[model samples]
Target: MKIIVNAEQRDVSGCTLAKALEELDFISTAIATALNGCFVPREQHAETTLSEGDRLEVLAPMQGG
Candidate 1:
């Protein structure tokens, strides 16, 4: 299905949030995820389900010296 991922349109599939992440090859080191404005813990990804029109915000950690 076509959905907005971090404000960009992309194709993602699977029955749950965990599956979608796997399908999209979202690496753990690259970002942290918030679904519909709520923070989702890594351990809860498998328990969370993705629904239509749900907004996802991916926050990428930056290194500062």
Candidate 2:
């Protein structure tokens, strides 16, 4: 399936958010995820289903002074 990740097009084989994240190499537990502009809780990633043309945003915390 094809989806937009952080504004870039990507082809993923996973049907669920969790699997997609794994396939995308987003292994950090400290990261945040949003689907189609809606916030998705970490606990729900496994059950969250993704579809073609869906927008997926993955954000990670940044360290700054």
Q: Which candidate is the best by lDDT?
A: 2
TM-score of each: 0.78, 0.98
TM-score of 1: 0.78
- Please state every model's RMSD to the true fold in angstroms: 1.8, 0.4
Off by over 4 Å in 2: none
What value does the lDDT take at residue 3 in candidate 2? Answer: 100
lDDT of each: 0.79, 0.99
Clashing pairs in 1: none
Q: For residues 1-65, what per-residue lDDT tens digits would candidate 1 score against the true structure?
A: 76677888777777577888878877675678898888998888899988776777777788999
Q: List the candidate 1 regions with Cα displacement exceeding 4 Å.
A: none
lDDT of 2 by residue, 1-65 (tens): 99999999999999999999999999999999999999999999999999999999999999999
